[model samples]
Target: MSTSDFVETSYCLVFSNDKLRANIDTLLDRKGWRKEWEEYQGKLYLTVTAPFDLLAEEAERVKLEKKLNTQANSMARFHFSKFTHYRGYKNKMTFFSPAEQARLIWSALEDTPYSKNDFGRGVLPKFNDQFPFCTAMKSAPAFGLEDSYPLHSPWGKRRFNSNVSFRLVNLDHAVRDYFGEEVAFYFVWMLFFAKWLLIPGVLGLALYLFRPEGVTVDNSPYIPLYSLCVPIWGVFFVKFWKRHMNAVAFEWNAHDFEEEEELRPEFWGEKRISPVTGKIEVFFPEWKRYTRYFVSFLVMLPMLGIALGAMCLSLNLNNYIRDEESPLYIGTLAVFAQPGGIFAGDSPYYGYLVPTIAHSVVISILNTVYRSIAFRSTNFENHRTVEEWEKSFIVKRVIFEAFDCYLALFYIAFYRFDVVALRNELVGLFWGDELRRVGVEVIMPLLTMMFQRKRTTRKMRAEKKASNEKPIELSQAVLDAPLEEYDSFDDYLEMVIQFGYITLFASAFPLCSIISVGFVLVETMTDSLKLLYLYRRPRSRRAGGIGVWYSVMYFMVIASILTNCFILGFSSEQLMQWMPNMFKHEGGDQQFKLGYGRYVVGMVFTLEHILILLALVIEHFIPSCPRSVTTEMARRKHLAKQWLAEHEADASQQKTVQKTEHVE
Candidate 1:
C-alpha cells in the first residue's frame, strides 16, 4: 500500500482524571465526534475515523481532522520524552533536579506511540532512572515518616540491592535507548575489558605458580611466553571487541543513527541565506578553523618539551635519592640537610620521598594547566560542534598525558634494567624503587576516599541545617546529597596504567597481576553502584567508536612486548652469561659490551617488527562487522524492496476497479 493508505487516520483519547474525561466529552459533543464517542475507563472516549472520500459534512470533518492531528503530535512528543526519561535541563544545566525528574514521567496510556504497532516493540523502560532510587521511593516504609531512621550504612546508602535482579542485556538496552550510543559504547567497553582481563589474570597466576626460584640474572622461560602472549591476546581482544561492538550498534539501530547525527548543540557560525529554503543558515569558516588548528601544534610542541623536561628531572632525582652508594647522595644530603656524616641512611628514603612527591605535584600542576590551555585553544579554533572540539582536545591531552603517565616505566625498562651501567650513570634507579612507586599508587586511592568522605560528611551536616528541612531517615546526612559523578575516561586510564604496571614489569614484580586483579574486582562493583545511583545521569552523547582509547591500550601492549624483550636481553645475567658474544668489548676481564652489537640490535629490531606484523595480520583477518549482521541487513533490504513492489501492484489493481465502477 501507499504511505497514506497504511498511515493511521484515527487516534484514541485516553484520560487519567474524571474531570478531564467530562471536559473532553463535552467539547467533542459540542464541536464534532459526537457519534464516534464511546465509553472508555467507565468515563468517555472520542475516536475520529473519517475516510478520505467521505460525502459527510466537510466542515465538521476538517475540524475533527485538525483536532486528531494536534493530539497525535502531542502524544508522539510525550511518548518520546517517556522513553528518553530526559528531565529538562536545570537552570544552570549543570545537573538534573529530582523534583523535575519526578514530574517528567508520563502516564502509561499516553506514552504508547502509534508507530510501535507497525514498526517494532514499544518503548523500553528507562531503567537507569527507574532502578535503585525509584524502587526505594516506591517501597521505602519510612518515606513519609517525620523522625530520622537508620535504614542503611552511610557508605552503603547509594548501593543497589543485590536482590534486585538486573540483566546485562536489559541494562545495555536501557543505556543505549536513553543515554545515547556514546555512553553505551563505554559501558560495553568496560564490560569487554572486565571480561578480557580474566585471560591475563589466569595466565599470570599459572606463570607465578610455576615460576623458577632463585634465578637471578637468568631469564625465566615464562618471559618469552609472556612477551608472545600479550601482543597476540591484545590484538585478538581488540578485534573481538570491534566485532561485538558492531553487532551491538546494529542491534540498537545506532549504526544508522550515526549517519543522521546532527551538529552538536555547541556549534555556532556566521549566518548565510539559503537559496532553496530562503532562510538564514549558520555557516562555519573552515579556512579559519584549519589555520588555527595548524598554529596550535606549533604552540603545543614547546609546552610539551617543558613538561617532558620537568618529568625527566623529577625521575632522575627520585632515582638519585634511592641509591645509598651514590656520591650524589652525599651531595644531596649536604645541599638539603645537615652534613652527610650525621644523616647518611636517612637521606636516601627522604631523597626518594621528596622527588616522588615533587614528581606527582609537578605532573598534576602541568596536567591542569595544559588541559585549560587545550580547552581554550579548541574554543579559539571555533569548531562547529562539541564532538569536533573534544576530539582535538583529546588528541593533544592524550599524547602529553600518556607520556607524563608512562615515562617512569620507560626509565625502569630501558635505563634501570642495566644494573652496572645504571649504577655508574645514575645512582638509586633500582627495580625496588619502581616497586615502591607501584605500592604508593595502589594505596593513594584508599587514602583519597577516606579524606573525601570526612570532608563530605562535614559539608552535608552544614547544608542540612542551612536548608531548614526536616531531617530525613538515613544513617548519615551525606546520603541526602547526590554523589559525585566519576569520569569514565579517568577510571579507564587508571586501570590501563595498572594493567601496564602488571604486564610491562611482571619480570620485576610477579605479584602485580594479583594486586591488579583484586583492585579490578572491587572497582567493578563500586563503579556499577556509582553509575546506577550515586552519579547524576550524564547528557546524551553520540560516539561512532570508543575514540583513541583503543590506540592507548594497543600502545601499552606493544610497550609491554618491548619491555619484556629488554629485560630478557640485559637484566637476565644468565642470558648474558649464556650468550657472552652477543656484545663486543675492548680487552677487559669480565667487562663485556655496555650496549648491543650489530647482530644483537638486528635480532631485537627484527623480532619487534615480526611481532607487530603478525598482530596486523591477525587484525586484518578479523572482520569488524559480524557476518550475521551483514547478512541480516541485506535480507531486510531485499524484503523491503519486494514489499514495495507488491504494494504498488495492489494499488494499481484497486484504481482499475474503481474506474470501471464509475463507468458503469
Candidate 2:
C-alpha cells in the first residue's frame, strides 16, 4: 500500500455550526467521528467515517470538504458532504486522513469555528472517539442499515436531515406565513376534534360512573355521535388546516422564499387584483389558476342523511345480528370496525356515512373558501395558462379531499380509535359507529388514496409544477376518452387487478375477516384500476401519497385495538361483576372489572405515543442524508480542479513540488 493507504477513508459531515451537531446524536445511526480544529484558520472541523473507495475519488473529496453548508451557497466549502473510500470495504464509505483528524483532541482544542446547531446540555450519542466538542463515531452502521442514507440523528433542533417530512407549505419571502405558528387554527382543529370525542365520551363516563348501576335503558345514545366525531374530526381538521396552510407558507418562508413574486402586494398584508375595481384580497396566488369562482353543494342535506344513516345503520345491524348466530371468533382486526366474536345482540353500526356528510360539508366549505378566493385572484396573477387553468381547479380540489382521506387513514392506523377521538368517545366508537367495520370498508382505502394524492401533488402552485405529469388526470382521461385514442384499457385493468390479487395474499384469521380483507383487496385494486382504466382521466391530479405511511399507522392501530377488543369480548376469560362471581359461577369466569378501563386507556395512549416517538427517534438518530451522493460529488469538484491546475503548472520552468495545492 502507498502512503495514501494508511489514511482510512473517513466521511465527515461538515457543519457550519453546532446546531447540526446537536441534532446529529439523534439524527445519525452510524457512530464514528473526529472533530479537528484548524489552529491557523481558527475554524473547527469534523471527520466522519466512510469507506476508502469513496474517499480517494476527487469528486467525493471536494463534496465532503463543504461542511454544514453555511459557508455561502456561492462559497466552496460550507455544505454537508461525503469523503473517502475504503480499499478493503468497497461496499462501505471511504473516509478522510487521520493525522489531520487528531486536531480535535482536547489538548488541541483552541479557537476554531464551531456549530451553532448543537447544545452541550442534551445526551450525546455513543461514538468511537471524542475531541473537545468534536468526536469520532463509536459504532459502525446498524445491521441491515448501511443503505440508510442520511440516517436519523438524535440531535433535536430540527435539521433538514432529520427523518420528519414537513412541507414548507406556502412561503412567499414577502410576509409571515408560518403555518406552525398558527395557534388559532391549531386551537380550532383541536377544539373541533375534542368536541366530537369529548361530548360523547363525557356522556359515556357520566353514564358509566354516575348512573348508580343502571338497569334502566342505556341512554348512551351519545356513543354513536362520539364515534362519528372521530372521523369527522379526522376529516375536518385536515380540510380546516389546509384552508390556512397558505397562511403558514406565508409566515414561515415568505421572508426567505417567494414562490411567486410576480404579483407584488399593494399593501403590506394584502394584494390588489383591480386597483381600478378595488379588489384587495389575500389569497394563495399559486393556486389561483386552478380555483373556480363558484361551485355549491347542498351542505346540510348529506349531514342529516349521514347522521341518520349511521344511526339507522347501527340500529338495523343490531336487529339483523339479533337472531343470527355469530360464528364470531376472537382475532385482531383493522383500525376500522368489522365484526367477529360472539356477543349477545352486538350491533355492527356500519353506517358511518352519516358523519360523512358532516365532515364532507365542512371540508367542502373550507375548499370552497380557498377556491373562491384564489379564483377571484386570477384577475391578479396568471398562475397558469387559461387552457390549463380550466383543467386544473377540479383536479386540485379532488386531490385535496381524496388526499385528506389518506391522512385520516394514517391517524386511524396509528392511534387506537378512542385516542384519535376525544377521551370520552371510546365506548360509542366500539358500540355504535362500528368504526372498525366502517373504516375497513370505507375509510382505510379512502385514506390510502387520500395519502396517495397528497404525496404526488403536495407542491405549491402544484398544477403548474411542470416536471410532474398528472397520473390522476391521465388515468381519468384514459378511462373517459374515445376508444380510438387509446386501445389498451383491458391490459391496464388487468395489471391493477393483479395488484389487488397480490394484496389479498395476506388474508385475515376468520372467514369474515378473510372475506373482508379479500373484499378490500378487490375494492382497492379495482377502484385504482378503474381510475387508471375507466373515466376521462380525472382532470384532477393527486398531490402524491404522503398519506400512505400514516395509513399504515391507522392499520397498526386498528390491528392492535381490535385485537384487544376482540380478545376481551370473545375469551371465556372476561372479568365478572365481582370477585365472588369469579369463584361462584358454575363455570370459572375471568371477567374484567370496570375499574381497569383506565389501564386500557393508558395502554392505548402509551402504545400510540411510543410508536410516534419511536419513529421520531429513529429519524433523529439515524443519519441518512436526504440529498443524493451525486450532490456531494458536485461539491468536491473545486478541490480536484485546483489540484489538477497545480499539477499541470508545476512543469513550468522548474517549479517545486511544494507549490501544488495537494496538502495531503
Each candidate: RMSD to true structure? 15.3, 24.3
Cα lDDT tens digits for candidate 2, 1-664: 2334323322223233343444454432222223232111122234333323323342232232222222322223211122111122332222221211211111122112233234242233322122123322211121111111111111211221232222212111100111112212222222233233343334334434454554321223322232223222333323333333433322222112211122221211234464466654443453432332322233223433443333333322222212223332112211122344222122254333323333434433444464564344433333323334433443343334333322332222233221212111222221222233344334564566555445544532264356575433322111121211111222222222222211211011111122333333333333323322221121111111122222332333333333333322222122122123322333343333447646545544564455445444544553332233235335545644554454357545234555564553
- How far does residue 547 in candidate 1 sit from its true spot (Å)? 3.1
Per-residue C-alpha lDDT of model 1 across residues 1-664, encoded as one tens digit per residue: 1333211223333222333344334433442231244332243333332222121123122211111122221111112112222223122121111211111211111122222122123221222122222221222222211111111122222222422234443444444444446666776776666677677667767666776686531245665555456656767777888888778866654454332222433345777887788766667878978899888878778778877677556544544334556432444433443334322325654444455455556665777788788887877787755567767887788777767755665665575554332222222222333343344333454465457666766665666688996543322223322234335665566566666665565455544455555555555545554554444344344465677777777777777667665655554342344466664434431334656556565766776777778877877887889999898667655654554465468778889999999999
* Candidate with maximal TM-score: 1
Give the best candidate by lDDT: 1
**Deviation in angstroms for 377 in model 1?**
2.1
**TM-scores across all candidates?**
0.58, 0.26
Off by over 4 Å in 1: 1-180, 216-218, 259-284, 298-306, 320-365, 415-486, 499-511, 541-544, 555-596, 632-664
* lDDT, candidate 1, at 621: 81
